[model samples]
Target: MRVRNVRLIDGVSAQAVQDAVLECGDDGRITYAGPAARAPEPRPGVRTIDGQGGTLLPGLFDCHTHLGVPSDRSLVEAALLTDPVLGVLQTTERMKRTLDAGVTSARDLGGLPAGFRDAVAAGLVPGPRLQTSVGVLSHTGGHADGTLPGGKSLDLDYCEIADDVPGVRKAARRMLRAGADLVKICTSGGISSAHDDPDDQDLLDEEIAAVVDEARRHRGRPVAAHAQGRAGVLAAIRGGVRSVEHGFGIDDEGCDLLGERGAFLVPTLSTVFQPLDPRKTTPWRYQKKLRWNERAKENIAAAIARGVDIAAGTDAGISPHGGNLSELSYLVELGMSPMAAIRAATSASARLLGVEDTLGTLRAGYAADLVLCAGDPLRDIGLLSAPEQIVLVAQQGVVRKLTLPERSGSCQT
Candidate 1:
């Protein structure tokens, strides 16, 4: 496949090359990338695609997501209790919406079941390239415990609740045995949890270390900590977790530790502005936690200044599925340049996810995942918010979505 006359942002930098041609082989790997005039002659029966002079860049990635689940426990329970099959079907629809929004890859933080990863990989469904964590590990009454304050116990199948170091290690190993691609640990309380405060550290440093140690046993799999408060963030960093999610109350000391450890921060900014809908049913005690929005932004800016790697993630299940792109705008509002924000969503995120060798950038021997837009994203990030501007989306060199129909005429030699 030959894509011609496109402005190429190779994911290496902010510069865009004009009149570029990207050639892909049958195996869905980029074989050639250079000036259109310098591209090799087409084979006798090869297909050609004209880019309509649009900007082409590596596809965006959402580093945090939850599948087979809803942010609201009531909705999740209702879906499961009413019809299990229908619940999975709804999850599939959400996945499709995520891909249609041009997110080529996503990391499922938790809530996915066994065999779900293989099902997606086997082409049984149309969705992004998925990497799953199975279910999160939390202490009893911790963020992932799903316990209410009225002594009512919610479903705990989606998470492993550990109360000690040995329990934490056992839980981490269990998640890996269940076919998780990574390990997710809830080191802090969260706004969505009815029994805990978001500013509190729920897991001890030793317990977090045990989870990280167990995760290291699985080669290539990293530990992701759902940390919100300063103490939790510090514990995650000290425990050698690869990435920190939320970082709601990350202070200067926390920022310094993250910078020193070279840990990646996935600040899910969309969660801050999540609407006050009845479906949310967030606890009133947790409402005070939302006030950390400004502080979180300041901490993120500090991290960026201190050379901490920043990646883009929307905490998708908390917000709507297709609205993940809103995170880019928030990052920019928090002082990240548009180009940097794009890189964070692409190359930087891939590196953090340990898939940089094959996925992130547009280069020879890399996956042919690309998104073509009508305008340059570097000039205005808002262009991404409009679905009409997404002219084409190609995954593994196959044209999955296109705004304009293919031309009928043969290639112009």
Candidate 2:
């Protein structure tokens, strides 16, 4: 497949190539992507697509997502009351919507079952390429602990209640055995956990070290920590976590620690501003969101200023699925340049997921996952917020979504 008459960002370059042409081979890999004047001639009977002066770039990546649960349901209902079969069906539809929104790749931080990833890879579902952290490990009363006041704990497949160093090690091995691509753990409290404040530290340093050691040493998998407070963030970094999710309470010292350790921060800034149904969101959750909303941007901006790597993530289960790209606009507002913001969702995110070699950039020998927008996103990143602007989406050289202007004749030249 060949796509021509477009501007290309390539995801690695600082600028776009005008009148660019991109070619993908039958083997699902890019063959050529550069200025049209320097491109090779099309093979006989090959399909061609005219991009109509659109901007083509590498397919986007949502570094953090939870595709298993419905967004409208509260945590308690989603974990305890959701029917297993119905939940799978709902998640499948959400996956299609996510792909339609142009997210070709996503990392499920927690709450996603591994079967969805297998299904997408096997072509049984229409969705973005997925990497999952089968479940999340947390200490008792931590952010992931879903216990009721009556002493009954939530029986969620995605939540593992572990305590101390030995218990966490065992839980980490269980997740790895379950085919988790990465191990996820909660080191601090969050908005949804009504029992603890967002600033409350949850896990011990030894416990974090044990999980990280278990994950990294056993199968060479990376660990992602749900850390929002300063102490938790620092502990996760020191324990060799690969990424820190939601570092809302990080200070300068924490920023310096992150920079020194070379850990990427997947800031889910959209979580604070996400619209929630009043009937579902409790009063305490709403109050916690308001408090975090006030300082989330400032802390993330400070991290960017300190040269800490920032990757884009929406915490999509909190925000809505299919609106993953909205996080980029928030990053731009947090002082990242348009190109930088795009990179955060593209190349930088792929690096965080450890798939930079085969994905991310629009270069030859890479997977042919691409997206075409009606206008240049560099001028106004908000254009991405409008779903209509997404003209086409392709994964592994196969066209998944396309909306081109009706031409008078065939595209073949």
Measured by TM-score, the strongest candidate is 2
Put down candidate 1 lDDT per residue, 1-413, tens digits, no spaces: 77777888887766778888887888989987767777777645666778888888888889998766665556446534757777788788888777777788888898877566677678888777888898898888888876666776667576789899889888888899988888999888887777676678887988988888788877857899999888888888999998999887787788778878878899988787665564356546345555676677777777766656888888887776777777887888777888888888899999988889987788889999988888777788877767677778878887767885554334652
- State the lDDT at 105 in candidate 1: 86
Q: What lDDT tens digits, residue by residue, belong to model 2 across residues 26-126?
A: 89899999999888887655668889889998999998999986776777787778787888899999999888888999999888878899999999999
Which pairs of residues collide in candidate 1?
none
Global CA lDDT computed for model 2: 0.86
Per-model C-alpha RMSD: 2.1, 1.8
Please give the range of 10 consecutive residues that has the lowest summed lDDT in model 1: 404-413
TM-score of each: 0.94, 0.96
What's model 1's TM-score?
0.94
The lDDT values for all models are 0.80, 0.86
